[model samples]
Target: MPHIYAKYISKVLELPLKRDNFIVYDRFVNERAELFFVSQDGVDFALTLRRKNNRYLIKYDKATRPASTFILTKALSNLAIALECEVENSNLALVQKKESEVSPWLLKPNFFEKNPTFLDGKQAELEVGFGSGRHLSAIAQEFKEKIFFGIEIYKPAALQLLGRIERENMPNIFVVDFDARLFLQTLPSDSLDKIHIHFPVPWNDSPHRRVFVKKFIDEAFRVLKPNGTLELRSDDEVYFKDACGLILEYKTSNFHVFKNRQILVSSKYEDRWKKQGKDIYDLIITAVKKQNDDKIECNFDFENAMDISIAEQICSLPAIVFDGIVVRFEDAFKSESGAFIIKIILGSVDMPESKYIYTRDGISSFYPTKPLPIRDNMIAFKKLKEKLYGKSN
Candidate 1:
């Protein structure tokens, strides 16, 4: 997980008084530190307060970057005021540093919500593994009407593109940092016009980790519009041939192959490889059918809260698989009043939905982050509900 830098302040025996501005969680807390979350206008930021070297300081807890620095800055300001303490290095420099580090639009919480409109029903294009974003950046700028979704799990590459998007102010482009294979399942069928995977990791030694798995190809086929093309450009012959073979595994699929094809907007890696006189390969698979979206029914209400001690024991135990769905409690924390929260994973083994379940005031439910409306999660939710509440009933 990435972290934000902060200067030291006075050491305190315990955390400062809780305020409405901060949303704190103790699941990840140990003897040394506590974690708190803050959200501004639906954009979330994290604060890690800890004591080190006889002094106290705060660090921003972020996996990638915060969507809104302004909110974080304001939250910090409010904290300083509410706590009645003076921060030594408090100035515009700190705020500027946070804002300049990443763009606000990079990690908007409701980004997927806007996908439905998708440039007012214009065609949607997706570029998976958009490293350096050389191709994705140019294409998004060129096609203003089309909504472009660039998926890149690489932190630096995604942030670089985020800066470019902020500079160019391209409204049609949305960048997401997640595995392309899992993210595809969240989309509706026939939602994309074109899909591009350029210069992905070969993962030759760990072939199973490669992106062109059978399930991924099947997902691509399901999400793409009829005649929509899934383009893959690669320099690794192993990956190229493997991807081709995976697509061909489906007897109904048709594709076009190219050798040493030209790249319109070359990435840094591509430029370096091309200078060395390396051969490039391109494979384009066109979908022939418009499949229906997978039915998802993963929501349940829990009104009975379990005991804090029991919840903690459950979280520390191994995962349980019910109805082919794997559900595990990752962490447990008890509040001052004995209210407890458990961070959990619910869904298929490959892509489990990570969220929290809060048992407070004699009730429990999925919380902090809602489980995605998917069938695997629904099944997991049913099993979990039964596991926790069945005995009481």
Candidate 2:
């Protein structure tokens, strides 16, 4: 959300040039704003500079932002420097200094790079939503041979745990800033030794957003090795019961429930909960047998450029929903270079992916890349393709 206010912006600026830490690759313009495809620290996204209250406000295009705000802030500051425009009420000064320390254990979501194998078939354990480094760090130190993957959606918590990993020199621990529900889908069947969900958000009001949905539990069971366990620890009894209900929906019911059970490590919240006399709940599901590695085969390829009128028509309709998947064309931007960038949100109802697609002369592909090759995503992709460019040949 870092932004700067400038008095004026040049209308005739071009791209494909290096500017400090940012590389301006392309520019797009519409009545609403002017957007530039920029890259910094190997992260590609769009930056927008638009008129507001007789002044210009520049910021990241929300649909294409990277996971780390620090990186975005740095890029924005460097961009301001490149623009050579005076700004007001900006953190541009703070990020102008030397770059902050980055951890070696942090990872971006690169699941689709030639079908790269995460952990390379090694015996691994996963901790979803590792708020602090306490549980994951402790387990990693205890089991040096087994790799530990920690998934967190919050940037600050992930950064903090990454710092702890670096400080403690725990090379076995890797942290990813992503949604655990989607991340689980990327893992291979029977690849993980254990999966842990500790202190997950209850999401009572938004049950669809809960991590223990039927599909997530199905994925967890799929990824667990034979005799492997998927454990859930929570201070909220409602969430615990909800998870139990969902797990029972599966074919196998090799699971157990515990109350006020002790673990290897206790988080500060757990300690406080115990002091307040709250009954902690635990649900452990055991993988009774190995699951088949049913890999989903699909691709996001466009053979022809879509007509402008068709694109506009599709964008005007409500979201297309089918078989637990939803595809929606959110917005469309026509670049100055006669290209179109269509912003889209599509995937499973519980875990959707948002990205931009660049369409121009002899060019039609996802902006950064395609969505993760999960079953739900694949279904959504095919459905979206049919809607846009007709049934595949």
Candidate 3:
């Protein structure tokens, strides 16, 4: 999250302010702090202003931040300038980034409204969690005939890759800022020629966060064409062994495990690991059979206004767990207006979405429209809605 620290001025700030293609729509204040909802272009996020001893600490509301940071960074810079306050110290310097500077290769999650047919008839391949974009760029340059898709949740890495794509003029490569697990589920069945998972996070403390899980493997196989491969390269021996065992036990046993095998392209991290005498492992699983694409169907919209009593009760519950769904109400904030800003963590246990639900004048809605349309998330959405507004026949 980009933020800035400025001198605190004992003066009232006006609302509905506009500066540099950004508008501060509403201001919400409570005993704790104040929230200014700012919109840049069509994207929106909140700037939290907290008064310290003699300075104001301004930072982004993590729950409401958009996936890409390009627009948000520029908007924050403009807001800082509009305040006209003396800056103290900040990571987000007052630098404006032009919209034209944004790379066309970058994509938001909404780009996949349904099963994406953007690939047309071209041979499509994907690399999960492209950290440095080196391997992805190398392969895309080598395979000029195939369309390459790279998924990375890290904002900085995604932006860096976007810069590389533009600098190198790789029109065939596309970068998506999203969870690879959910992204795979949104692709048409048997559409991808190959899926690459190179040096994914080990998640030793929490194995559930790893990319080589059973559900993810199932989705990978589903999206891969017949005889197409799902390749996994890692430097973590434990992760490699566990992933191999899981794949062998849960899915088809048609997979191979290699040690220190070199590929066509290598990432810098891989080079460092090899220099340190680290053994690199590779697991290549070939899809044995084709599977049908299952459309994810669910909506986060409420049929009626939210009941205040139900909302209040939800604010008190530690957590609501049903089957594979878990909903936890984290915090509650009251606005100057008669509105409730409730922060919650709900959805699939593996990849729960943390978001804010805004409620005012009886109407309630998710700040960012909706959560990812994964099956577990859909289940959790239904259960949460039922608990909030009661079951609808």
Best of the candidates, lDDT: 2
TM-score comparison, 2 vs 3, better candidate: 2
lDDT of each: 0.68, 0.80, 0.78
| Candidate 3, 1-393: lDDT as tens digits | 578888854445576788767998666765677777789877877778888877888877877776545677877777777777677888765434443244677775666665377776779899998999999999999999999999988877887888777788888998888778777766777889999999899998899778789888888888788889999999998888899888768544688888988789999999999899999999999876644555657877867666556666778887878775788887676655567777788876766788777887788888755777667777777777777757732
TM-scores for candidates 1 onward, in order: 0.79, 0.92, 0.86
* lDDT, residue 284, candidate 1: 93
* 99-147 per-residue lDDT for model 2 (tens digits): 2244557665655245557556688999999887688989899999999
CA displacement after TM-score superposition, residue 74 of candidate 1 (Å): 6.5
Ranking by TM-score: 2, 3, 1
Best by TM-score: 2
Which residue window of length 10 is worst by lDDT in model 1?
1-10
Total clashes, candidate 3? 0
lDDT of 1 by residue, 1-393 (tens): 222324443333234344575533322354656545445445454455666555556555443135445566665565445434446544534455444344544643334444555434569999988888888888888888788888887766777777788888887788877767667766777789899988888999998777877777878888788889988889999888888888777768789999987766777888898999999999999986744555646446774667777776787778997555798987765555455666688887776767667676687766555665555667788778778867322
- By lDDT rank, best first, the candidates go 2, 3, 1
